[model samples]
Every structure is written in structure tokens, then in C-alpha cells.
Target: MGSGHDTRVAVVVVTWNSAGVIEGLLRSVQGSRLDGSVRLIVVDNASSDSTVQVVRELMPDAEVLQAGRNAGYAAGMNAGMAAAGDCDSYLLLNPDIRLGPTTIQSMLEELRESGAGIVVPRLVDEFGALRLSLRREPTVLRAWGEALLGGRRAGRFPPLGEVETRAEAYDRRTEADWATGAAMLISRECLARVGAWDETYFLYSEETDFALRARDAGFALRYTPEAVAVHHEGESHESPALFSLLSRNRVKLFRSRHGAARTALFWSGVFLGELIRAARPTRRAAAWALLGNVRGVARPSS
Candidate 1:
């Protein structure tokens, strides 16, 4: 956020009742870019709390777009990007992220040099813990791999879960199918070429879909160590909700890429896995979340 030569950044953040984290995120961005003037756009996804009010107070100059209804994640982003038309680039960030120095600049540079459509930073948490936001799109096999290796056995083996800490996990710069939308920088050209986040996905997996499309459109997805940010990881508060969304969205992504038979088989395997997990509390609960989405379950909040 430091350098400036007339390239305006449309820092779009989508929030819903995020009164607790919004202020700090804005301040962090403000802190990151003391050297330039940034056009901040905060999209309020029909928050029930004082999230909108807090944003107004903390970042008065920010153009707050009120989506009176609780338009899901992709919708909020699409709205913000449409409003931010023709900017140098659009940064689709989580409301709880605090970017490191020159993170955006580094991402923009990589986007230019690598001919990439999207660029994502090394995402870390407040406690200096890393979250795996950058990833290979979740396949049913990957999901099963996660269910077996992650969640329960996370403390036992740490390496199985460093999917997002690219800077730490990989030694050199590389191309991915897509980077996480959180703390991601997309070139304006890529935006026009690949288009917006698919509205079909409410939360999870949309970026992955967009990334795959960008790749097919001949744009590489880059993960740069230089562009780093402290991601608060606030999007998934309830384990149940995240599980459901990720599971369901994974189905949609699979169907889009694969075929109906493969998709059906995937879900069938997931179903059996849930039955086997019935005796275990943590596994059973997580399994139920996966089931809820497969059964077309709707989040009461969504």
C-alpha cells in the first residue's frame, strides 16, 4: 500500500455482521498504505449487527455498498468489483486480514511479470500461525484425505496441512490452478477475460472455479512469497457451517469439471464414510455437516 503513481486500488471487503473485526482490518489496510490514497469499498451483506455503522465510523471515506439482503459471498464480491470498474486491480480480501508491507505491490508485480490472472499472498494468522488458504481445488479424494489426515490428526502431523503457506511449503515461485480469493489480487485484464466469481457458490470454492477458468483462458495462477498478509481466518466461525459449504461447493465444482457418474460416486463414498464415523463424536459431527450440504441443506443464517 506504500507506492503510488496514479494506480488506484479497489480494496473490496465483504462483511456480514462483522462489527468485531471490520475496524481492525480497515485500520490494518490504512496502516499498510500510509504512503498513498486508496479507494476502500466495504460491502455490507445485510448485517444484523452494527457492522455497517462501525465501518462508517472507522473508514468514513470508504464507499459502503449496502446489499440490503444477505447476498452471499460471491454476490457481494461481484457487486464490489462492478463498482470498482477499471481500477488497476481488485483485491478481494477478508475483513480480518492485516497485510504485510508491500504485499499488494509484490502481488501486482508478479501478476505483471508472470502473465498471471490471479496472485495470492502467504496467509498467516494473528497468532503467527499459518492458514492454508492457497490450495489445489478440493477433490473428493482430497476431501477424504483431509478427513483422514486433518481435523482429528492435525496435532499429530503438521506437514499434511501446510497447503496454504506457500512461502514456507515451497522453495520457489510456482503456478497453481487458483489461489484463495482471500487476500488475492487479480489483474484488471484477467477480470475482464475470466470474469467475476461465479454466483453459484455462496462461499467456498468459487475462487477455485474462477482459477480453473483462468488457467483454461491461458493465465497462470501465481503464489508469491513476497506478497504476505496476516489473515485472521474469521470466515469460518462454526465448524459445521464451513463443512457444509465446503462439501456442497466441492460437489458443484466436481460436477462442473467431471461428470455426473463421478459426482454421484463421490457423494456415495462420503455418505458411507459418515455412517462409519457415526460412533465418533468429532468425526460424526463433521460428517453430519457434509451430509447437510449434500442433502441441499440451507444455512438458517444464509
Candidate 2:
């Protein structure tokens, strides 16, 4: 690890019609306390709003890359990282996140101390409520566990679920299988070894694929509780189409890593979970989408 004065960092933010919430993130970046040089790069995914204008107006020194079209999050992240040139580390952030003054520095320190290729900070919502951001590797058993019992309930038992929801788990630094992509710091070496984010996933599960691949390459994914950030979440929770995409991507990601039989079992578990929730009006679309019954919904480019 390089000394504080010499470490170079690149901060990448991918935006899509995010003008409303992006200002806070930009201001947080501006207010960040770091010892080394930091480059700010924003990749706009053909947002119809003033997201680009807002970025330029607030962060004139930032490198803004127009993606030309509304490519997915992975594509925008790849574009921003490519435009960033070289750096010791890359901090990937969401437009709705607010960083503490020393969030970046704390993450960097944890990365150096733990020798982790990727590090994620403790995430909270705007209300200051802790978010269950950590996840274990996806497996058929875990999938069934979540399907039978809801994520929050199943997560109480480590082997029963993928998401780590125990409050005590977030009280200290520990290695994770993966975590939410809203805020993460990736070491240069890990980025080099893992290559780029898999555009195949487009948005959801892309971070999981990258983190798992890093672990496959013998790099640890560490969670540093001291480095905290506030994430306002995203549209996936409310938008049925986005939620459907997230569910579909989970199956796709699991299939890529497991055998056909296991993938089918995993798919069954995911489908059952969606099916169980289908009675609710809010979950109807995702349930239909998972069953291949929904149409006219936009899908990620293949």
C-alpha cells in the first residue's frame, strides 16, 4: 500500500436521470477528507433529465462521460473507470449516497490493513437506519431458505440465507462473500485481475459477480464498519420492471457459476419466492416476469 500522500484514488459515479439526488453525492465528494489526489468521474447513461448539467455545474473539474445511450450500470461504471486512466484504487458510489468526511480514507486504510482487494463500508439509509448490505455466496440451499422464509427471517441463520442481516455482524470489520454495490473501494490490483465489471449483468448482481470473481482469484472482500455511508437505495424496490430485472439477473448470475441441475434448483427457489409474494399487488409484476409471463418490459442488452 502506498503512503497517504502518494496514494492516487479515482471516484466513479454512474448516473441516470439522477439530477434530484446527485447533488448531495457531489457535495460529499467535494467535502471528503483525503490525503492523496482524487479524480472525480461521472458517467451519464443517456438520462433525459439535467443529471449531466447538474454534474458539470457543481463539479466542473470532474470528467463527465456521456454514454450516448441508457446503457446499464455496469456499462457506465466501465466507461468511468476507463476514463479515469490509472489510479491506486477506485471508489464506486451511487448517486444517492452521502459520504462522511473520512469515509474514503477509512476504507483505504482498511484495504491496506486487511490486504483486501475490495472493501465495502457500512451503509445506512437517510433515516440513519442500518441497511443489511452484506451477502454470502448464492447457493440453492440459501435460495430455498429465502424462499421458504423471507430474507430478513432467513438471514438470522448464517447458513440459511445469502444476506447477512445480523446486527452484530456489522459492528466490526470482517471479510464478506460480497456486499451491496452502492459503495465499494476496489484496489488497483484486484481491478486489473478481475478485469471490468461484467456488462452481461447490466445492473443487478454485477457487483456480486465481480466480488465473487475477486475471491476466486484469492482476493478478500472486507467490510469496514468504520467507513460509513448513507445510501438512499434505488428504484428497484419500487419499480416492478427494475425489480423483475434484479430477480432475473440473480438467476443468470447463479447459472453462470453452477451446474444446470443446481441452477434449475436455484431458479425454482427464486421462482417460488416470487410466486409466494405474487398475491401482493406490488410484487405481481416481478412474479409474472420471473414466470416469463410479462411483456413489453425493457431488458438488459444481451
Candidate 3:
């Protein structure tokens, strides 16, 4: 892992019952082709399984922070960053992500050269299909349009949605409102200027909130396709609890950014969207959960 140049990086992997995938991710990190000095820190959010033990056994050199309770991803990441100390960059890596050998070097190079405060790698599935990680800022009109048109088609037409799910969209490196937090490389300068991840998000939309904050603070968010990572996605999609959290948090994020008027409109759009999706057999339960949580979705306890 030598380019004969030194760039210090602290890789923070947040885990929650991630024993099944984290070992491979850590191993991939150990075999990374970067020339930088890297510190691996695993922040586990009170995983009930053997995630902590597995991380300890497989990657003995990694610093492990045992957050005794389920603090959620944002808080867990903050804990990892607190432990990581100072570094040129902080990578908020998801436990289920496996990085390629050249991933770190390529991303770091783009970040340094492009002057972007945050840069994310191209995320693909195990079979090499692109995952739509990039996204535009959320707005009431976009939300309503997406509800009426569906994500895939709505995303293709920019005004219709916030999601950028088109495959060809990832062909070039570009600036984005936010990308998936699964494997983001954030500059220390950005962190210092914009502050830490907003813990109020609990889980979903935390990255969105952070990215928007960085942009507002004059930090650019970039998507560089040269660096690639594989993500075992769909964990949230499979869980009704997570789906409900995502639903509520989507509205929360909109409210935080646009205020009451837009939030109300966006919430209505989201409800209608869920109602439409619920018509499908597979999404019925998740749709019900989301609708149920509409009035009583608990806010993050700060």
C-alpha cells in the first residue's frame, strides 16, 4: 500500500450485528493498496450478535469502541470519530461494504485534486450492478411528483424526484447534494467547518443532513466513479422497523431543511407514495408500518 507519499486516514466502520460481512470488509481494508497511514476503528452499536467479537478476532489491530447501547448509526459514527482523533480524512464506512484494493487511493486522489470536502465511491452489488447512491436535494414538488410517478421513472426526470437512480448517471464524476453514507470519505477540514454528524437523525437521513450542511458551508460533495465498492444492500428494505424509521426520517429531514409549509406538503406526498407502493404484495407490511408511524413516529432523543 505504498505510493511513497503519506496521507493519514482514519476509517470508521459502524457495526450492528454485522458479523456476517465485517470480517471481509476489514480484510479488504488490511489489503488496501493505498500508500497512506490508515487507522481502522470499529464502532459497534450494541450488537446483540458476535459482531464485536468477530471484529476483534479477525482484525486484531483495529480499535473497537463498544457503545453499550443501540445508539444508532449517527451517534455510533460520532463515537468512532471521537476515538479516531485527528487525520486528513475520516471514512464513514458501512460494515456491509467491501472496498476494492485501489478504492482508497483513487478516492483520496480525487478528493485532494477536486477540492471537494466529501467524496463517495461508486457502489455496486456483488454482481457488479450499479447501486443508485447519488441523490438530489429533497423538495415538496419532487416528493409529490415521485409519489405520482414512481421512483425509477420519476428519478429519470429531474423535476419529478430527488433520487438519481438512472444507471447512466454514474458514468461521470460530478457534484451531488448527497450520496449514500455507506462509504463516504470526508475531509477533516469539512468536519471542522461543518461540525459532526447530526445525532438527531438517529439513523437514516443523517448523511443527507450532514452533506447539505457541508454544502451550505461551502463544501462540495463529489461522486467519483473511479473508486468502487461492493455493498450488500437491502438490509433496511427488509426490516419494517427500519423502513418506518426511514419514512419518518425522510419527513424529518425535509422539515429541517424547508420548514413547516413544505414539510406538510412533502409528508402528504410521502403518504400517498407509500399508499401506492402498498398496492404491491411485497410492500404491504412496510407500507402499513410507515402509515402507522405517520402521527406517532418518535423523534430522536438527543
TM-score of 1: 0.83
CA lDDT for candidate 2: 0.89
Q: Put the candidates in TM-score order, highest first.
A: 2, 3, 1
lDDT tens digits by residue: candidate 2, 1-302:
12355778999999999999999999998888877878999999999999999999998989999989989999999888888887999999999999999999899999999899999999999888999999999999999999999999999998889999899999999999999999999999999999999998888999999999999998999999899999997888888888988988888888788766777787788888988988765467777777782221223224
Per-residue lDDT of model 3, residues 154-198, tens digit only: 999888878897888899999999988999999999999999898
Give each model a TM-score: 0.83, 0.95, 0.94
Alpha-carbon deviation at 166 in model 1, angstroms: 8.3
Score residue 109 of candidate 2 by CA lDDT: 93
lDDT of each: 0.72, 0.89, 0.86
Output the lDDT of residue 290, model 1.
Answer: 62
lDDT tens readout by residue for model 1, 24-137 = 888777776433346789899989999999988887888999999888888999999999865878889888778876777777778778987788887767886666665665
